[model samples]
Every structure is written in structure tokens, then in C-alpha cells.
Target: METLRLQTFMVFMLSSCGFVLSFQINHLLYTQSNPTAPQTLDRNDASSILNSNFDSSLPVKFIIHGYRESGNSEWALKMKDELLVHAPMNVIVVDWQDGSSGWYFTCSANTAQVGEDTHLLISHLQTQTGLSLNNVHLIGFSLGAQVAGNTGKRNPSIARISGLDPAGPDFSGKGASDRLDPTDAQFVDVLHTDGEPLWQGGFGYYEPCGHVDFYPNGGTRQPGCGLVGEICHHMRAPAYYTESINSDCPFTAYPCTLGQESCSTCNGNCGFMGFHADKSQANEVFYVETNSESPYCRG
Candidate 1:
């Protein structure tokens, strides 16, 4: 009888150890396999593909693309790569089913669809990543800027929204203007490239934020293009993403070359000669250059 009792106790101990090991293995796999780990969205079929190993404490950065652009744009990818220098935070590129076209120049139900889809994505982020209002930041370019602006205004979860050279033309006027202001967002900053595109309303028309208008490289056509009549669309990334706009601007003359120098003016005829949005705000506008200059209009 003593031998039998001892045998029973040994079996129980071995079984308990095995059970504990199995439970731990299962938990690890569950967290690893599921992308949106903590809170999985029932709607998206591929939400499980996201890495569940996200930092809960760090802020979440959302990058929204333009109308016809994808999350895989060269600039978007580069920014994501550079931003990784700051760890702990997770960067998610939002790709909505927006109709293909000029991208910067389009407005319809399809446009609204992009905004709606973005909100849904944000909601999903909140659930899975455990991000709160102050923990979210948005960066949008052109129409993407408008999309970010509208979404930030509507969604309280967003902390700050940065509009990189908002697309002009279609998004001008009074009623249309009210939707894209800095005040509408928790904190908004509008950077205009073709500030007052002649086709739209000329320079310095839209004023969403009474303060905080930032201009990079004179806020006009991008640098490097030599005497080109067209506006600088390619200049968006270099203008904002670079170390400073002043040095980069001269390089991107209208007829861009290896070494070119052009006077910085807004005549729209000179190479790299372009003027964009107004920096009339009281806040010291950051030309986004390494040099420290007052953020106001200069000749």
C-alpha cells in the first residue's frame, strides 16, 4: 500500500509539469501568430498577419497615401525606413481603395470612401495596438493630407496631424476650406508647395489655422527643375524630408543639373523659382532647414 501511494504521487507531479509546459507553448504561439494580437478585428480576414509583437507603450504613427498612390510609394517607404531610427513605435502604412486619377485633383464618393476606410483602419489600430488619443500621429501628403486632416478632425483618437503641401485647386473656397484647418485637428500644420497655384486662386488664399503655416524652400515650385512651367510634385519629399530647404531648393532648379544656382523668387519663370503658401502666422514657421531663420515671408 505504501509503494502504491508513492507511485500515484509521482505520476501527479509529472502530469502537472507537462500540463504547465504545454500551456506556456500555446500562449507563445498565439501571441506570435496573430498580428493584431491583443484585439483582433472580426472584419478583416488578414488582420492576423500583423505582428502581435508591437510596443504598447510607444506612440503609433500612421502614414496615409494620396488619392492614386499606394502605401508602397518610394517616399513613404523611405520615411518608414528613416523613422525606424526611433524605436518602440510602430509604423503602419494605410492603403485604401481610392480611385486612380490625378490623385491630388479629385473629389467624389470615391474620395469619401478613402476617408471612411481610414477611420475603420484607425479603429482597428486602437483595438489591436492599444493606442489611445494622445498616442497617435498622422502624416499625409497632397490629397492624403486632406484625408488625414478630415479624419483627425472627426476622430478624437488622433493627437497630431501634419499636412505635407496640401493639394490646391478643387479643395479651395469657403465651405470647402472649413474642413481642412489646423483648429479642426487637435494640432494641425499645413505645408503648401504650390501655395496659390495660378489655376486655383493665386498665392496665399486658404487660411485654416490662423497660426502655424510652415514653408520649405520658399513654398513654391520644388528646387532643381530649370525654368519649367509646371509645379513641383516630385519636390514634396525633398522639400520636407530633407535636412534643410534652403540648400536643397537651389539644387532643384527648374532645369535641375549637377551644380546650378538660381535666385530664390516666386516669379514662376526662374528655375526652382516658385512660391507656395503664406507663413503669415505669428508662430515662427520652420522652413524645415538646419539653419535657424524666422518662420516668416522673406524676399
Candidate 2:
């Protein structure tokens, strides 16, 4: 608990002290429709894949894994498979394990460079393949959420950004410009499944940082998640998202009044939360419930 408290306080302190963390990140692109081996690229090599197996005409999706995770994390791998299985997309997975797997504070600070690098990759893809930035979608988890938000800010033409439980400790109360936010993209959707305040052992930002924010089962404690030592709630955001990729039953949600966590009543205005999420049909502060097991969607 004390450590978590310091995470918040030290963020301010470090920023005030002008401490900067800089590093390069690995960017891997995989085409669900193409079925070739993964294309590994970085800012310096974004053009390498432009010649190999990339199709510029397809909609591009970038999945960024968060703190301590690599390109092969279960969530990233699963989400990657799901996207491929459901749609024909140019899925690019951003791997920042070199920057992300380290002291928490260092990884937190490295997000700035990670975002910058992503912007560079997108710009190169646009130049080489005529890939429209407007068709770009970025999905990030934990601190990767901040990276995506920063990328969207740097490249405003990005179509959408989905933050699966953005990291909270260093970013919980920071302004939109400093963390994941709605204005980062044309459509920003956030799934808050572990938004409990930091002192309470939560690691995901609680504020509604997206144009449409979905809270499943209060977005704090999930229905069947073991509270102690299991951040199952935080992990739920990506699992549900992965499932939404191909599930016949869509996860839908309703609006929650202020000071409310979860609302049981489903309304006509309900919006689908995951892969079926349509920015045009979105609402703020949406609440919904899901089953504890797979096929969690209530439809």
C-alpha cells in the first residue's frame, strides 16, 4: 500500500525534477489476412516491412502491450489472434518490453519515447504504402494506454484508440494531455475493469479517459475475480476485448449516474463495449455486467 502511494507521489516529484527516461521500442506488424511470419520493425526499419508483406489498402490496427509485457504476452497474442480470426486487418503489435520491463518509475517515464516512436512508424507506413492514418486503430493496455494516447495526440488523424484499463499509479489524476484521454483520437474507448483507487490496491486509472468508457461489474472488483494477489479485474479488460473479436454475444452497456459504479438497468441507449463498439453509437460512463467465465458477454 505504501509503495503504491509512493508511485503517485513520485510521479509528480520526478516530473518536477525534470527526470527523463528515453529508449527505443520494438514494433512488430502481423497481417491476419496475409498469414506470413511477423514483420519486425522499428522507427529505423518501418520501411523494411513496407516492401515485404504489407497491404496499404487494408485498415491498420496496432496492439500495444503495457508495462512488463512483450510482444508475446498472452493478452497481446490472444488479441492478435482474435483480430485475425474476425477481420482482415494489418495488425501491428508494439513491443516495448525493453522499456516496459524494469523499475516501474523508469517504465512510466519511457512512455513518452514509446509514443514518439509509434508516431514515426505510422508516418513511415503512410509514406510508403499510402496507408491512411485515418484508418489506424491503436489498442493499448496498462501503461501502453498512455503511449497510445500520446501517439494519438502526436498524430491526431488516428481513427480510434482503446485503452484496456490504463495504468493508474503515476497517471490516475493527471490531465488528459499527460495520460490516456478521449481527445487523443477521433474515437477513444476505455474499459475500466480495475479502477479501484491506488490506496486500495488498484493499478488502473479510474477516471473516464475515453469518449466512451465501459465499466463491467463496477469496474473495480469483477464478479468472480479473487481479490488478493489477483489483478484479474485489470486483466479482464483485455480478455473481454479479445473475446469481443469473435463472440456472437456482444458485450453491451448503459450509462451510470455520477457517484455510481455499476448500474443494473439496461436502456435503449445501450452501446456495445468491445469489438462491436461503434464510436458513433457510444455514450459516456457506460455500465454493464458480464459472466465470470469465457463467453462473458451478456449480449
Candidate 3:
């Protein structure tokens, strides 16, 4: 029976989702501080996969990668490091580098199954570690953001989810069930750093979809990003989030009043964004500006 289950796991890992494509989907999963030594969990081995503790009392953070990137990417590792420095918690990175490569549309289409399969993987881990679902936080970047959204859909009891500039390509203008929306979890916060309309080289969703949607620097073109390469603008979302993890100054946001969606002004009470954010200020839009370099917090 054990051998049969292992064979089944292998078949699932090497098969494509549902786009008439069949290629090996290797998931280089990491549940440790070091990315160089990631354990492939699909082999049905859990006792030896992680050398750390998954305390049920503490929160679990899953940091996912974006297009053409893997768990070994700088952003993934940087965020993991920052989180560990801030708190002693469980951090896992989902590496779908094999499935997320190739054509853009193909990769976009693969997120649906990725979310489903990842949810199953997390569920399996929970059973082993006796972890609570309420203590899980999903922080997904770009396409991974959408995957996190779908994961929330798969398991609706998650405490909170942070969509770091969810990819706008196949998800924009989609319904709440189709893309990242407020109902996906108990609290959902989104950061928009590259919301330029799709017609204008935008890499992120332009609309406010989360409970608290933060638009830093007008949420269009970032301050230091070049005029031509929009990737830098999109990448700023995770950078700012990483800095917010351990910075002396937090990323505070100003509320936007009625009919003031695009206003660069601040009104009413303000709240901090990212890891230290308050969930009480949900269903609102926030705006803030940052410096051109490290310690981007203006305050």
C-alpha cells in the first residue's frame, strides 16, 4: 500500500493540469530557512522533510514565487529571511518552477491546479503536524498571488492572506470566485505597485480586490523603476513588503474618501500595511509614498 501511494504521488507530480500539455511538474518545496536544500515532498516522505518545528500555537507563512521564478529566487529567500528575523515561525516556499515556465498563458493556466495540489500538500502536512488552519497566512507574489487566492478558495478557514501584486493577466476583471477577492479569507490585504492599465504595460491588477488594498506611490509607476522595464515596477511590491517585515518604520497608509479613489491625499484614520497591518480597517483603499531606496517608509 505504501508503494502504491508513492507511485500515485509521482504520477500526479509529473502530469500537467488540463491544457493538453503533459510534462513533469516538479515542485521543489522548502520548509526551512535554507533554499539550497529543499525537500521534494511529493515522494511521500514527511518525517525527514523538515528539521524544524511546526508549533500549532504559532502562525505558518507560505511564500510563493511569481512568473519565471522559483523558491530559490532572491525575493523568496529575502522574504523568508526577513520573516524569520522578525518572528520564530514556520515558513514554507512552494516551488513550481517546472510548471510555471514555458509560455505565459500556459503558466497562467497552471496556477489553478497548482493551488489545488498545494492545498492538498498543506492539508497533508497539517495532519502530520496537527497544525491549525486558522494560523495559516499565504503571501503569494505575481502569479503566485493568484494561486494563494485559489488556495484560500480551496480551504476557506485561513486566517489571512496577503496578495503581493497578484498577476493581472488571466485574472483581471474576473469575478470574486475567479480571482483574488475579499471573501477568500477572513482578512485579505493586497499591495498594488504596478497597477498601470493593461494597455499601458501594467503587470498587476488595477482594481481594488482585497479587504484593504494598498496603492503605494499612486499604485502606477513606482518611483525608482525605469521608464521602459515594467518588471522593476512590479517587483517593488515584494521589496516593500520585505522591508516592512523588520523595519523600525512601518508602511503606514492613508485612507481614501468617497469618490477619491485616485486621490493622493490622506483622510480620516491611517493604518500600517504588510505584516504589521491592522485587519479592522478592511473594505477600504489606502495610499502612501516611499523613498527611492532602502527603508522606503516615509514616516
RMSD of each: 21.7, 3.9, 9.6
Give model 2 RMSD, 1 decimal.
Answer: 3.9
Off by over 4 Å in 2: 1-24, 33-36
> Relative to the true structure, how large is the alpha-carbon lDDT of every model?
0.45, 0.80, 0.77
- Tens digit per residue, CA lDDT, model 1, 70-93: 656666655555445534465666
TM accuracy, model 1: 0.60
For candidate 1, the lDDT comes to: 0.45
Residue lDDT tens for model 2, 1-299 = 56655565445323432233655477777886454468776557645765656677887888998876798898898898888887788888898887886667778878888898899888888876788878899999999888999899898778999999999888977787899887788999999888877766677888888888888887887878876224677899999999988888878787786348567666667788887787865547888789988879886
Q: For each candidate, give its TM-score against the true structure.
A: 0.60, 0.89, 0.85
Q: Please identify which of the two predictions, 1 or 3, would achieve the higher lDDT against the true structure.
A: 3
Q: Which segments of model 3 are wrong by more than 4 Å?
A: 1-36, 48-53, 257-268
Top lDDT model = 2
* TM-score between candidate 3 and the true structure: 0.85
Query: How many steric clashes does model 3 contain?
Result: 0
